[model samples]
Target: MNNFKPYYAVIFTSTQATDIKGYLVMAEKMENLAKQQKGYLGMDSARNEVGITISYWESLEAIKNWKANTAHLFAQQKGREQWYNWYNVRICKVEREYEFTLE
Candidate 1:
């Protein structure tokens, strides 16, 4: 789904702590829960020494709702307490996009 119109992107960038117990499980759970939320468009993520996750939504209100979700709040706390060494979140409006693919 190529969404070209205006939308919201929640960009989460982080560096993980060494002892990442249950981190992957919680990450997966959060992704699954995000899929069930209203206005959720899509998500992309990758991790190496640093991790980046960008979730797309239809509106700012949608993003705010996701941020305030109870389960996500727990995950945020866990990330601060144990999982992440440091993290940053940026919410932006995507006004336009372009892509190319070979298949």
Candidate 2:
């Protein structure tokens, strides 16, 4: 089905981290806190040697708000300081979307 429109997606990609001391704690806090923010659609994350986290937002502003949040700010500092070796964030507009389900 393709009903979603005007949505935004934030893709976070990172390589294996070496000094991720409090990464898990901070990540959990961010996830829980993000759900309480307005315009939150959903989020999905996966990792191996590399990690990726994709979060959906109703608008670009909401995503920006999240990015600038205080807790997120701390997380960002932590990432740069210890957690991630390298990372990149990409924002994209969802012009169309399709999903499938089986029962």
Candidate 3:
């Protein structure tokens, strides 16, 4: 991720539907698309029983533009129709963060 501190984070949590047939393909596409957008800092994601994705952005306008993007809107429609059984999205202002590593 970029050192874009004081950024925004869009947290997406979901449980996949039983039939996730094009989910991975679409997810990859969306990630790639997000990278092309303005103010896209970075993203992190993981999944097992439930999936979580956190996308960092420079501003709320950037987040809003991404949400209203054509392909993303399609993906969102597909997510409601096919990909996710349940999902939640939270947007937050990340004032600060810290990490630990072993050397």
User: Which model, 2 or 3, shows the larger lDDT?
Assistant: 3
Query: Against the true structure, candidate 2 has what lDDT?
Result: 0.88
Provide the TM-score for each candidate, comma-separated.
0.95, 0.91, 0.94
List runs of model 3 lying over 4 Å from the truth: 1-4
| Candidate 1 Cα deviation (angstroms), residue 44 | 0.4
What ranges in model 1 sit over 4 Å off?
1-3
10-100 in candidate 3: lDDT tens per residue? Answer: 9999999998999999999999999999999999999999899999999999999999999999999999998899999999999988899
Best by lDDT: 3
Q: Rank the candidates by lDDT, best first.
A: 3, 1, 2
What clash pairs does model 1 have? none
Q: Which 10-residue window of candidate 3 scores lowest in summed lDDT?
A: 1-10
Candidate 1 matches the true fold with a TM-score of: 0.95
Model 1 lDDT at residue 69: 99
